[model samples]
Target: MNNNQNIAETAISCSGISKNYKKVEAVKDVSFEVSRGEIFGLIGPDGAGKTSLFRILTTLILADNGTATVNGFDVVKDYKKIRECVGYMPGRFSLYQDLTVEENLEFFATVFNTTIEENYELIKDIYVQIEPFKTRRAGKLSGGMKQKLALSCALIHKPTVLFLDEPTTGVDPVSRKEFWGMLKNLKKQGITILVSTPYMDEASLCDRIGLIQNGEFLKIDTPDNIISQFAENLWAAKSENMHTLLGDLRANEHIKSSFAFGDSIHITIAENYEVEKLIEELKQKGHKKISIKPIKPGIEDCFMELSQSA
Candidate 1:
């Protein structure tokens, strides 16, 4: 088939992509594909090469090794076309700070050789949230409003593939939820979204996720699938003295791993170890109101396991 047919099958593809900053390797031979109109997330913390990969894919920077294609166009040779067809919102708010919200959106539309009237329906849901402040300067808007305005500017051009780098970092929890909702609606409109975020809770929001760390992807699969791969016997532990509980649990030979989760410590014990024995040991050590029980592993647990193994 032709390039258009190929483009219909995959929105983005990268093979052996690598980038380095002097002595540091930002990305290490990473490869992945995002299907058209799907929400594929790069789930990792800051400096895990999420931004580096995004820059390479968006053709803003060249990869030191390997190749990447966006909408079937080679990133290096077809950069101009890729730039025109893809929308990118970097980790920082990179819009014109001095310009009003309406002006910023109009400017992006003009740069893409399109008018707001042409693609207004595409960003109407998002723009309407910030339309009342259309005259306000972009820098003066609140965190949530700035996020919405940035999203509006990114979508003004009606790009085929949208790349968002840490879009919800500083926004309130409510805005973060609403931003993901907007993404779901955009997916319905046949726009492919590749978003990066450090929030583990947001992993479940995507169709699939790649667990990245230190510039490498430890695992890539649907959230459920990855969690299913966690075969260890996980348990949650809590005591009146939360601070001392972690050290005591790790000091025990039966405990294989222990990490503090919200309001408790999650641990994986030695195979065939009895939970009662561990509770008794804690009780002897003066840990009052001790609570220990089996628990299912989440994305964070899986990441810790994978990182340890790697």
Candidate 2:
């Protein structure tokens, strides 16, 4: 990856990236690439080492092994260069909580040796939303507003690539949706984004995603591709006694996998199931309101299956 690399080429690349914390392996030989200007997602649950990997890539910390490059600059030798070319939002809100929103934004801008006015266009859409409360202390902002202010500050210097670590972990549903929308808009402006999120649903919004688990990548592909590769027929199973139903479904000889999903259970059948016969069997076992129907696999389903296999 070099300056000549276009929007479609790789803007970020990591080869055998790994990090360890005493006894625990935080990242293990994780490798991937993010094309320039693409909204590439690193999807996994918390404590899966997402933050560790993000720290290494964003130059906040060094990996014990392997190499990575952001904007064609090495993570080690070109750390300073990488810092100047990328913007990072950590999992935690790290802004000056006591400072006014405007002050925080200005502080970040000055640290980068740039003025807010110099890159105002890059952050205008996001910043304008929070500008009305610019004089307010950042600690007093609502979750959504705080999220917006953080994003505005991240973009204050207009870096070529952005790294967001679990950006939507604790926000409200609407705010999460709004934040992702902002990322979509940023993509149109040709800024490559590497966003990590523990939310499975958000995985579909990325141009491509790398599914990680326990410090290792289980799979990497477009969401649709990952779902298409799901191994078995899936069914949504529900009954009055949903808890017991899960155990019963898992005990069934023909069932390959069974797990609770929301109010219903997602089941992967080992072979063709006779729906009517299965219902009759459950009824004989005293299950009422029993309903089972074939269901399409989503990112969560794919993740569950991969995790089990891994």
| Residue-wise C-alpha lDDT for candidate 1, range 160-236, written one tens digit per residue | 89999999997778889999999999999888999999998899999999999988999999999999999798999
Q: Whole-model Cα lDDT per candidate?
A: 0.92, 0.90
lDDT accuracy of residue 206 in candidate 1: 97
Residues 1-310, candidate 2, lDDT per residue (tens digit)?
3543543367899999889999999899989999888899999988889999889988889999999998878999999988987899998998999999999999999999999999999899899999999999999999888988999888988888999998898877888898999999999978899999988999999999999999999999999999999988898999999988987887788878888999999987756667677788889889999999999999999999999899
How accurate locally is residue 126 in candidate 1, as Cα lDDT from 0 to 100? 92
- The list of candidate 1 runs beyond 4 A from truth reads 1-6
Instruction: Evaluate model 2: give its lDDT.
Output: 0.90
Pairs of residues at least 3 apart in sequence or in different chains that clash in candidate 2: none
- Give the TM-score of each candidate: 0.97, 0.95
In model 2, where do residues sit more than 4 Å from their true spots? 1-8
Best by lDDT: 1
What's model 2's lDDT at 75? 90
lDDT of 2 at 304: 92
Candidate 2 lDDT score at position 63 = 96
